[model samples]
Target chain A: MENFAALIYVISSVLFILALRGLSHPETARQGLNFGIAGMALAIFTTLLLPNVGGYFWIVIAIALGGGIGTVIANKIEMTALPQLMAAFHSLVGLSAVFVAAAAFHNPESFGIGTQDDIHLVSLIEMSIGLAIGAITFTGSLIAWGKLQGTISGKPVTFGGQHALNAALGVLLILLIIILCAGESAVIFWMIALLALSLGVLMIIPIGGADMPVIVSMLNSYSGWAAAGIGFTLHNNLLIITGALVGASGAILS
Target chain B: MSAVLIMAGGAAVSPLVFQLAIFVMAIFVGYYVVWSVTPALHTPLMAVTNAISSVIIVGAVIALGAADASGFSKFLAFLGVTLASVNIFGGFIITRRMLHMFKKKD
Candidate 1:
């Protein structure tokens, strides 16, 4: 059974790679998207058929609600705003990873707790990456939206010594990360999160309107990598591989 | 991680397959929705679309938060935020430019 699942997963991954390739050219982008969707649906169906899926009611509800809302938004949105919509979608992906991590953390026992303070490394990795990336993506997306909506100026938001400020923040985030790696440090996580948020703001602030597409592509890749990182943290071979593929292809497309 | 185990057990589908399916469906759904609703929106509807797209980023980030990952995973989360902001705002600018194209001299 696992082997079959793996095989399906592998094929799906290949499709994703191809879809991305197709997406690079506007002419084939639609077809690529179709292929990608088909692949994802297959994966989801397989997931639903898993043995321990006792909570069918909630799962169904979530699928229905999410799908309905998504459909409405997609149909109603305009082409002129396509770029913004794409950005928002990327942000959502990051947020999803974050939520997944949180859920996993709360259910450590279900994640397979070992004796003698057996910390689930995979779970920890998932939680850490999810939280950090999720937070950053949330703030960044908001800023992007604001800029698009003209609630905020599209001009790069920079001040004297801004680069230095970014450097300092980067160093701080790295330091916090080191602490978090050694053990669970909620404080470090909080600080690093703040730093990342500020960094996100600063990074976009300096970029001009012409660079939005590049920024969008970069972010998509980041979100993909974030998912893959979660997959790694959880020791989910499928997630890591798929996430990496998404990230790499997105980079190539950009 | 328990998360991995849970994922491993669930429906046993491949990520590639699932994501690809989602992507294709999104395009179709997006096209259909736009076709149906374009006439209903005012010319400035582009503004709303831009806003909606930004909101989607918020949704995606929220979703990622729901995931089970850490360290590098968290770092990657920032990528989405950065991208969404630029994308939505960039569109907003383009819309303004397009509008300018139609403006007659005072």
Candidate 2:
């Protein structure tokens, strides 16, 4: 039974790959989307059948709510707002990883903040990544949204000393990562979280409006890499493999 | 017997969903095909659809990755990202082509 599920998973992954290929052409994009969605549904079902997938009610509820909301948004949102939507997707990817990492960290087996368990390490890494990526994705996406919606100037945001500020923040984030590795610490976590959000804004704000598609693509790739990192934190072989596939493929295309 | 019942249920539902999905896909395929045939409105239509496609990715990633917090959830997150990447890449290629059409002297 498990083997069959695995087979379905593999097949679904292939479909996803093909769907993506087809999506590259406008003529075939809708069909590609349908294929991708169908593939995802299969993947989701396969995952749900795992032995550890406790409680049926929550899963069903989530599916209903998530799917319903998604359908409505897809049908209702205007074409001009699409870039903002893409930013929103990046933010969600980061948020998911962060939440999962938080949950795994708080699990009774680990030190809640810091410990040496492989799973905990994975969770922490994912959490840090999520915090950083999600924060940036949120703010950067908002900026992108503003630009697309005509609320903000479409010109790149820049200043004489901007790069220097980003460099200083980068150094601080690295130091914080090292500090978190040494012990279970809350202050350091908050510090890194702030730094990550700021980094996202800095990286994105300077990009020109004409480059919105490229920026969206680049952030999409970042989200994939962050997911792969979270997968590492979890020790789930499937997640690791899938995440790696996504990150690598997104980078290639972007 | 339990497995048989499960298989039967799967058989009953998957086909129906697949058919519906295909029908939905056909609408898009046909729309784009017709749009492409009309040189006058192609660029504007493509531009509009490109934006719609981007939002689809966002919605997919968020809906799939929300709140379940399982290993499966992580996998879904990755899937969401990949799907979005696909949408963006595909959308851009079409956009580039559309813009190129304007650049060339007609």
Candidate 3:
């Protein structure tokens, strides 16, 4: 069963790679979308077969509700509002990581996560990074979405010592991560998450209207990095590859 | 000694290194591929990528549907799937609309 799941994931990953190749060129972009749909469909079907899957009642409902809303938004949204929409989606990716992390935390055994004593430093680091980046992206994208949507000022928000403050917050997060490695510590974990979330907001607030395309692409990279972080935590190779592909492409576009 | 300890944890460390390598290389790959995109197609490109990002819906569905997944966890998972699907559906449909506009230019 495990082998079959892995095989299916591999095929899906290949399709995703081809999809990326197709999306890169205008001539083949439509074809690329087809590959993406096939990859996603295959991945979903294979996951459904997993022994761990349950509670289909809610899953079906969520898909219907979400898919319907998405269809409506797609048809109604203007071309100019696209950057905001992209940022909004990026937030979802970040929030999804947070959800996954919360789930794994509540039920570590299902994810093959061992007790604290047997935990490797690397895994802990990966979880923390994933959580932090995901949190950051979530909030940062929200602020960007707001700016693009005209709910907030489109001008760059700068004040005294902004850069210095961001740097300090970053260094503090590193310290918290080190402290977390000393033992199981939820307090420090939440602290790191909170600080990272703040940094995300602060980072995006300073960029003005003119640099939005760059900001959108940068958030795209951060979103990919967040996904990659989740991939490491889950020990999913395909996720790592896909996340890196998105991250790199977003960076390149920036 | 710490390096040796990291080596002892090579199995865990290796995945991180491998992912980092992929991340770094993908930047180059993405740069070349995305760089070649025409400016006129930028809107469509962004929309297409937006659709692609919905890939997270897969993970969300798994989490929500996973055996014995709790109510709150299921809720979060539900949220993820819904939001991601919105991105996917909205992104692709909009991209198609944008692409249709390109015909006027031609």
Tens-digit lDDT track of model 1 for A225-250: 66665554444444555555545544
Q: How far is candidate 2 from the true structure (C-alpha RMSD, Å)?
A: 12.1
DockQ, per model, reads: 0.05, 0.04, 0.44
Q: Model 2, which residues run further than 4 Å from truth? A: A1-8, A25-31, A108-123, A252-254, B1-106
Cα lDDT tens digits, model 1, B5-100, are 565677966654444444443334333333322221222223223222232233223323433434443334334334434433443343344334
Candidate 3 DockQ score? 0.44
Compose the digit string of candidate 2's lDDT tens values, residues A1-254: 65776578567655555455444555555555556556656666676665544454544554555445544555555655656665565555555444444444433132123333333443565556645654565567666666666778889999999989999888888788777756647677667767777787788789888887667656655555555444444433233334444444444433
TM-score of chain A of each: 0.84, 0.81, 0.94
**Best-matching candidate per DockQ:** 3
The best candidate by lDDT is 3
Looking at candidate 1 chain B, the ten consecutive residues that score lowest on lDDT are B36-45
- The deviation in Å at residue A39 for candidate 3 is 1.5
Name the runs in model 3 displaced over 4 angstroms: A115-120, B1-32
Q: How high is each candidate's TM-score?
A: 0.65, 0.63, 0.88
Cα lDDT of model 3 by residue, A1-254, tens digit: 76798789778776877776776676787787688778877777787787777677877787778778878887887767777887887787787677666555445445566553455677778878888888898999899898888899999999999999999999999999899878757677678778988988999999996787788878877877777787777776556666776776777667
In model 2, the clashing pairs are: A122-A233
